[model samples]
Structures are given as C-alpha cells and as structure tokens.
Target chain A: MPLARRIIPCLDIKNGRVVKNVNFHHGTWDAGDPVELAAMYDRQGGDEVVFLDINASWEQRSATLDILTRAAEQVFIPLTIGGGVTAVEHVRSYLRAGADKVSINTGAVKDPDLINQSAEIFGSSTIVIAIDMKRRPTGGWEVYLQGGRTPTGIDGLKWAEEAWRRGAGELLVTSMDADGTRNGYDMELHQALANLVDIPVIASGGAGTLDHIAEVLTTGKADAALVASIFHSGQYTVDDAKQYLAAKGVPVRR
Target chain B: MAARIVIVDYDMGNLQSVRNAFKAVGYQAEISPDPASVLHADGIVLPGMGAFGNGMRKLAERDLIDPILEFATGGRPVLGICLGMQLLFEYGEEYGGGPGLGLLTGRATRLPDTVKLPQIGWNLVEPVAAAHPIFEGLDQPYYAYFDHSYAAADVAPADVAAVTDYGRVFPSVVARRNIIGIQFHPEKSSRVGLQMLTNFGRIVCHSRSTLR
Candidate 1:
C-alpha cells in the first residue's frame, strides 16, 4: 500500500514546559506547558508527538519518561520520548510507561551496541536512532553525542546506515547545526539519509515555515518532518503543516 | 471492542511504531515480546526492522518461530512490515543464509548499487493485484516511506500485492492467504500510513470472529 507522510510536532521540554530558540545549542527560552503544548498539537492534528527532555540530565533518572507517561495518558496520538536515555532498561521503562518509541542520541554513539541492545529487547521499531548532528569545522556533518558535546568521526549518513544495520527501526535525523533556527531543515543531511535506508526517517531541524515542510517531504524523501519552533511558538499548528502539504498534493493523515 | 492487536516485540522488529500507529487511531494494541500474548491476540503484527538471519534467530531463541508459523498458517490475520515481511518468506541472504518462516515462497536479497541498496524515500508503490483489502486505504500510486537494502524476489505470482518503482519495480506489499506484508512503514507513512493501519485494524476487527 502507498503510505502517506507524517507531520510530527516535537516538544522540547525544560522544567516541564515547552521551550525553543534558534538552535538548542544556544539559549532556550520557555515556550509553555508540555501538556498544553501537546494538546494543542493533538487538536491541530498530528499523526504522532515527540517530547524531548532538553534538561533531563539535571533531573532524577527517567524524570522525563515519567513526565511523558503523565502526558501520554492525555494525548491520543503516539508519543516518542527522548533525552538522557542511556540503557536498555531506560528504553524498557519508557515503553512500559506508555511511550510508543524511545529515542536515543547521545546514548547510541556512546555505546553503538545500544542499538542492538534496544532492537534485541524492545524491537527495532520501538527504538529510534536519534542522530543529533552539527556541521563539523572539518566541513562535514559529524554526529554529536552526549547532549551534543562529543563529536563522533562517523559521517552522518554512514551512522544512519550503521544504525539500521544494527537494528534501529526509525531514524530521527536532527541537525543540531540548524535545530530551532527555523531557517529550514538541513536538506543535505535529510537527503543523505532519506535515500540511505528504507525505514522511517523523521526530519528535524530548521522548521520555521510550512514551505520548508513541503521541501523536505518532496526533496528529502523524509517520511515525517518534526517541527519545534513554529508549533512551539504558535506560528503554525499541526493543521497548518497538513493544510500546507495537502495544498501541495501530498496526502497527510487528517 | 475493537480488535486487540498484539505486536510481537522480539528484538527482530520495530514493534512500538506498529502499536503506536494503531493506538493513534483509538485501537487497542499490546506489545508483548512474549509469544503467549502474541499467539493470543485477535490479530498480530510482525513489524520488523533488522537483519533477517538475526531476526529468525531471535524468534528461534525465544521458541516463537513455530508458534508464529502456525499462527500465520492457521488462518490468523497477521501483518508483517519491512524485515518482518521479509522473514515471512522462505529464506534470506542477509548476514548469511538463514531459514525463513517459509510462509511465502520467496527469498529476500540485497539490491545492488544500480538500484541503490537502500531504496530510501517516498516512492510510488503500484499494486499488482486489484481490489486487495490490505491496500484499501492507500491511494492509487500512493506514496509510502521505505528504508531497506534488501528486496523480496522470486515471490509467488499470487502473493505480490503492490509493486513500487525504485530503480525498478519491486514488491512493496505482498500477501498469501491470511498473511500480509508491507515493505513500507504504514505507521510512519503519515495519512496514507494511517489509512494502511486502519485497513489492518479493519482486518483485525473482522477476524475477531475466527480468533476466539
């Protein structure tokens, strides 16, 4: 069957509220309550919801998952929880707590086997290989793990293939280089991995307008696009992106 | 009650996305890496996303291979996605030679660079058979997201459901009897994806009569 595309709204939560900025690498200003923010997207209508704990490090273990579980009970769509997820147990906790999928970025690069361990237990579909990337000073995109601190020499595209080979069901390719910038998605990164694996790829980074959504869907072959700034800032709703893409003749889950 | 879809959560596949896609539509699905729950569900989804041999090994290690084979062959409604779909075949050449469930007479193999090993992106999947129920919600020449290096070949002519064009026409969705498999992520394929899931839900609901 010909499957339609997904418009996913990402909620970067800090201190229990949605927050955003040009890039998370910079400063993040408070957006709003995560439940309220999530409900807004649910109303606007998104196929799935991704809630990332931007400050999970400073909190209790799995504080983010607890927050996600609380929010998930309220939302009808799928919720993918990320941030500070380092072990298989953490992934299990999220899945058991109600998260449909658990995303790992820093943890995956730190321990590449995290992908296998996750796929082995939770199944690859439940484990998302979240690649938080920044344009390296060396002129190529390098994967940054550990809250975007350590740079792994692995090329972004190679990492995507490797993750899939190691058994990650989906890939959340976020360009830390362009995250929250609202300029647009990192087309090069999106394009590279979009054609690399046949699995689902969620394109995150630089989503400021609906036109960028169309561009990523058409050019990057991304199954879904994750928007943070526009949705978090109330510039566009999940409906807005759906209408935008629909106007372009692309089918979206209404 | 709507069909209680059980997703087999062996490390062999992507199970949560399947459950999430169903739950998003208000359908109840449970994730049980355990086989007892898997065999008991009204309908089962084998949503896979990994190496084929290892997938079979995981199933074998958990003693799930035979039960799942019986479920698929015993007239239970089962849907397999990606590698899960590939595993339904007779065998695969991934990592090394591994025996498949042999539910369908075909083998999965890696595509050469000529067709781009992983035919990633949204491609137009053309249905080979007309009026198949699994593809009902999908639009004609609909777009489904795919990420894989291997493709199913030597499929039994009766099983090919949809043929998607990458560098060439390949089976995107295939079925035999009650078992159906899709190469695309119906969960992540957005609206069309949801439609596909809804169709599966419909099947699960319809199969409730026979399930008990």
Candidate 2:
C-alpha cells in the first residue's frame, strides 16, 4: 500500500507546556498549555500530532506521553510520542497507551539492533525512524542522532535504506542545518533520500509557509512534511496548509 | 435549559475542544472528574487519545473504571471518542495483555502492515447501517479526520455503524444500546464534522433535560 501524505503538527513538551528548541540548544523555551496547543492543531485540520519531549530522561519521558494522553483526550486524532524511547517495550507501551506509532532516534542508532527488534516485536508499520541530518561537505548528508548532537558519520541515504530493511515502516528526516531557519527544507537531502526506498519520508525542519510544504512534497518528492515553527507560532493553521497543498494539486484532507 | 451533558475527565485530555464543540452549538459542557457528575449526566462524552494501557491505568488509578462502566451500562447516553471507543472493547493488543471495560464484546488490534499503520488524513466515512439517529443529516462518504493504527473489527457485525477504507476496510463508528463512537474527529472535520457534533449535541438535549 502507498503511504498517505501527512500534515503533522509537532509539540516540543517541557514541564507540561508545548515548546520548541532551535539549533539543538537547550534554553528554557516555553509554549503554553499542551492541551490547548494540541486542540488548536486538531481544529486547524492537522492529520497527525507529534510530541517530542525536550527533557530527555526516563521519568521526564513519561510526562511527554501524559501530555500526549491529555491532548489525545481532547483531540480525536492520531498521536505519535517520541523521546527517551530506548527499547521495544517502550514502543509497545506508547502504542498501547494510544499513540498510533512510536518514533526513535538516539536509541535506534546507539543500538542499531533496536530497529530490527522493535519492528519484529511491534511490526515495522508501527515504528518510525527519525533522522536528523547536517550538511557534510565531504559529499552526502551525514546523520546526526542524539537530538542532533552526535554524528553517526553514515550517509543518510544508505542508513535510510538500511532502516527500512531493518523493519522501519517510515522515516522522519529533519535537516538540522535548516531547522528553525525558516529558509526552506534541504531539497538536496530530500531528493537523494526520496527515491532510495519505498517507505514514506516525513520532511522535517525549515518549513516557514504553505509554499515550502508544497515545495518539499512536489520538488523533494516526500510523502509528508513535518512542520513545527510555522504551526506552533500560529503563522498558519493545518486547514490553511491543506488548502495550499490542495491548490497545488497535492492530496490533503481539506 | 437543555439536557445537561458532562465530559468524563479523570484528568484525561480533549475537554477543551469537546467543550468548545458543544459550546459552538449553543450548549455548555462541564469537564468533571467527579463520578457523581458522570452518573447524573443526561449525556456524557468520554474522549481519549494516547495509549490504552496507561489510559486504563489512569482510569483505575483515579478510581473511574467502575463509574464509567456503570454509567454506560445504566442507559445514560455516552459517547466514546477515539481511545475511549477502543477502551470499550473487551481487550486491546497493546501492553501485551490488559483487560478493557468490556462494554463492547470485542478486542482492538493494530492494522496490519499491508495498510499504513497510522491511517492519517480526511478520508471518507461510509455508514453501513440505515441512518440511525446519531447519523441523522450526515452526508454519506463525508470526510472526517483519523489518526491511529489500531481499529475495531472484532466487534459483532450488528454493532458496527460505519466503515472507512484506508488500504483496508475497518470500523470507524460503532454503536450498541446507548453507546456510540466515531473514529474520526467530528469536532475537527469542518462543516460536515461540526454537523455531526451538532447532531450529537441535539441527541443529548432531546434525550435528557438535566443537561441544560
């Protein structure tokens, strides 16, 4: 089956609030009540919702899902919870709690085997591999894990292909260099990875407007584009985003 | 005064919009974690998202399980949203092995790999039964938003109310007795979506007067 294009709204939760971090820097960034934030996205026609907890620890991770639970309680939409997920058991717990799927980054790379085990345990369709990439002049994009702090040295396209082979059902590629820049998605990175595998790729970082979303899907050939800063700051609603995509001849829930 | 309706809180999410949706139709909704509020409600909405095991754990942790089960079984009108709908089943594939409220006689399973795990977007919803009161005035194949990998098919065919296709056919709305559930967000589906909520609100007001 072809992967459906997604209009996902992301919430970076910290201390029960929706937040966003730039350049992977840890400053006290705060967005208001998570429940209210999620509800706004739902009303605006967001397809899927993601809550990435900036507080990366075992106990703090549970708080993220709790926020997801609280938001899920109000918004009848698909929820994907990430952060501090290090094992297959964590994936099961999140999915059962109400998350349609679970996303992993540092954990999957720290232990490359986690992807295989998670896919085997919960099925590949339930697992999403989130990749943070930085432009490496040596030639291909280099993979960044650990919230864009650690470098994996592996070329993104190769790793993405291996991830799908390892049982990851989808890929979420975030361009660390362009993240929060509002310039645009890394077209070079997106183009190289789009055709390398059958799994859908969620273009993350550098989305400033509806046109950027359209550009990524049309030019970059991605199935979905993950937007944070644009939607989080109220620059646009998911409905407006969908309208723009639909106008551009892209399939969206309008 | 219209029939009084209350949302089961238990510190569960979605109270604001559910309240907002009800308010949009000129009705006020109260978010109460109180068991008495649920028991006395003329129409009740139980909304959920997130994981089933933790939600059930929270229900048990907050001592809300029996109260919710009691209200649904006692014939007070109750509507379960998303995960709330999933919890009504006998069990879920999540958390390895956990028991549900058993309000509906079936288990919920994650959609297999052949279909996208989380079927996201404004896909079409088709009513299988001949337009029940809950579905009054709703356009067939109207679009509603969905976000989840697990769905209900294990329920008896008689209980199924609506079905939507997403690489595979699955139950989107199910009703039995006074219970009803919509997998898509009626509150988020724009005009058609809002109309469904308006219909639900009217159902709450007409079926009971305490909601006013």
Candidate 3:
C-alpha cells in the first residue's frame, strides 16, 4: 500500500576506500574496499547504498568513479554517489559510471542553479541535493558546506524549499549536531524539513538503535534513513535493522 | 549460440548497469544504436531514463523507432524498462504530450497528486496475471524498486501483468504476446529484480527454441 521506507548504508569514501567519521570529521577509520562493501550490503538486503567521496580531489574523484563502475557491476540495488560534484559534467560522469543518482552538497549551495540545470538535463529524480545542517548558536539551524565545515548564513528550511523548487528529486539532510553522536537523529530538523518539502527526505546522522530509526520514519516523517557507523562497525547488518523495523511496524523491504 | 540480446542505446542514462545485471545472470547483452543489430537480435531490451519526450525524440533521431516497432511485432521477447516501458505506449502526457511507440494500448499519465512526484524507492509489485513468466519464482506482491512520476495509465486490463500503488495503482508491469514493459528497474531491484531478469532470459531462450 504505502511506499517502503528506505534504509541506505552510506559509505564515506576517502581515496577510493570506505571510511567512517565522527561528526563528519574526527575518529575516522577505514571500513573496507568500496566495491566489496557495497556488494556485501546488497546481499544483506540493503535498500540502497551511498558512496560519498569524502575528500574528493581530482585524482580521488576519478578513483571514486572507477569504484562506482566496478560496484555497479556487482551491486544490483540502487547506488548513489555524492560529494564534490559541482558541474553538470560530474553528474553525467557519475551516471555513466553507473550511479543511479548524484548528490550535490556544496555545489548546490554555491550555485543553486546547478540544481535547475542538472535536473533539466538528467531529470529531477537523478539529482539529490544533500544538505548538511547544524543547529545555530541561536534557535534555528543553518546550512553547512564543505563536508560540514563551513556554515552558510542561509536558513536550512528555506534552502530546502529552494532546492525543491529548483527540481531536486530528493533531499539528503545530515544533521551536523547529531552525526557520529550515536544518540539519535535531529527529530526537529527532519520533521520540519519533511513538512516543508513535498519531495522525499532522507534523514541522516545519529542512528544508534532501531527505535531511533522508527522514530525518524514515523514521527520524523522521513522517506528514508541514511546510516553509516552502525552498519559499518558490524554492530548491525542491514537485515537486522529491517527486521527490527518490520517488527516495530515500520514498512521496510524484507 | 548465446541469445543475441541487444539493448537499444539512444543516449539514455547508464546502460552499463543493465548489461551488468544481465551478465550477473549468465547472459551477455550488446549495447547498440544500430537498427540492424536490433532487428537481428533474438531478444531486445529497451532501457531508458529521463523525460519521455526526450526519449522518444532520441529514438526517432537514431532511426530506431521502426526497427523497435518491427521487433515488437516480430515476437522474440521485447522488454522495455522504465522510460523504455513508457515509450511502448501510444502517448505520454509528460513534457507536454508526445507520441509513443503504440506497442501497447495505453498512455503514460502523471501519478495522482496525492503522492510525491518521482515515487522513488521500493514498492510491492502484485502480479495481476499471476502466471506471467517474468514473475516466475518471485513471491507475490514482491518489492521492486520504482522511480518515476508518470506510469502507463488506462492500460487494457488483460495486458496488465502487475500493478503497484504509489498514489494509485498503476501498471508496474504490462505484457502482451512477446512484448513486456516494466515500470520498475529490475536491474536495481536486488535479487527479486534479478529473478525477473533471469526469468526474462529464460523466456527469450524458450522463444528461440520454439521458432526453430
């Protein structure tokens, strides 16, 4: 009846290798080979896998693309590649390399029209605008860029609306405050963004337990949850997460 | 000889994944824009992404329309995926209306406004025909990855092989004779999807033997 909420295991890749970070920076560790890890996730019944090229210089970006080409060969489920994608050509290259979708973070914030242009050429569904949000010292949240290092004065809620109007198919919102904390997702952030945009919102950051996932998908109203450390550390398999969700009455593909 | 499967390439999105999926199932498919290759293939897979109008225009530009149309009627398992599936219909209401291949008796219309556009993610595909070969070994109401805003609406009831609900029940899989159109990406739908592709491969092999 209803569309199943997606559980996407995000592979934060550095130099063509999978890595996990704390709060988008500290306590980084190598996970494994990107292609092998992706295939493993697919076998484990992951709904989708994201390869975020975390320090994607030109050489590393090419390396990531090579990984995607190889990963697409084995991983039969959807694969989304993100990070350091600034131009339309980058989007084209990723898709050609077999990425189902290309996510743009800083690229979108710098040139909001990149959303309009890429969505026009490649169709909206292929363009995912990843927004990294941090709670401002004041009350609301501000959008961050450059792997959540630079804070933009733009309001996170307003920027999401702009991206949607520009024809972004989905929003991958990562909470800088909650990321790597292993506490929970920023429910307030996800609930607000999901309510503002009609497009699908993927809630990222701080998923310690199954209840946190259930909370986000139900009360948070997110269409998908992007998980990293839990699955990476062998603490939980994607199937384990889905089973827990299904037991808790969350509609996950089992 | 191995089944001469040709995936029509008219500059649509990544066809490598589709070919890889076939390879994973012990089949090799050639990606070609040549109409002659398409006409000669034992099976044809029309894979596409992006807008429907652009897809049709690209097909027309490459002089592939007639060959594909001919292949559809000539039998031998013609499969269309996503936008390729939409193009098999008579008309598409996307990008301000355009003519399709008219291989099936329906039009691609936008999903109801009740749901989000580009209903991206996995949804349950309930087999309407119950015995279609493409659904062999698949659990009924299996989860398949779908990503599109427009789907084949007003399809003939008998031609509908499966249906999935987003905003409303739309034709997720439609089949008539040797031609099959699937709105979901079986290549990206994991094992359930791979099973469908494997079944399609079997259908192609059986059809070839039948012709001989």
Query: Model 3's DockQ?
Result: 0.88
Best candidate according to lDDT = 3
lDDT of 2 by residue, B1-212 (tens): 65778887855544565665677667788888887788787888878765678778888887888888888877767788877888888998876858888898787777777754566556777888746777888746667776677777678899988887776777888888678887776765655666777777877776675433
lDDT per residue (tens digit) for residues A209-253 in model 3: 978888999999999999999999999999999999999899989
In model 1, where do residues sit more than 4 Å from their true spots? Answer: A1-8, A22-50, A56-58, A67-82, A85-226, A238-254, B1-6, B9-11, B14-17, B20-42, B114-124, B145-147, B205-212
lDDT at position B156, candidate 3: 93
Per-residue lDDT of model 2, residues A1-113, tens digit only: 23335688888787778779876684546778877887788778777778776676767666666775566456656567788788888887776555656899888878889
lDDT of 3 by residue, B29-107 (tens): 9999999999899999999887899999999999999999888788779999999999999999997999999999999
For every candidate in turn, the CA RMSD to the true structure comes to 5.8, 6.9, 1.3
Q: Rank the candidates by DockQ, best first.
A: 3, 2, 1
Model 1 chain A worst lDDT window (10 residues): A56-65
TM-score of 3: 0.97
Model 1 chain B: ten consecutive residues of lowest lDDT = B113-122
Between prediction 1 and prediction 3, which has the larger TM-score? 3
Q: What DockQ values do the models have?
A: 0.08, 0.11, 0.88
The best candidate in terms of DockQ: 3
Name the best candidate (by TM-score): 3
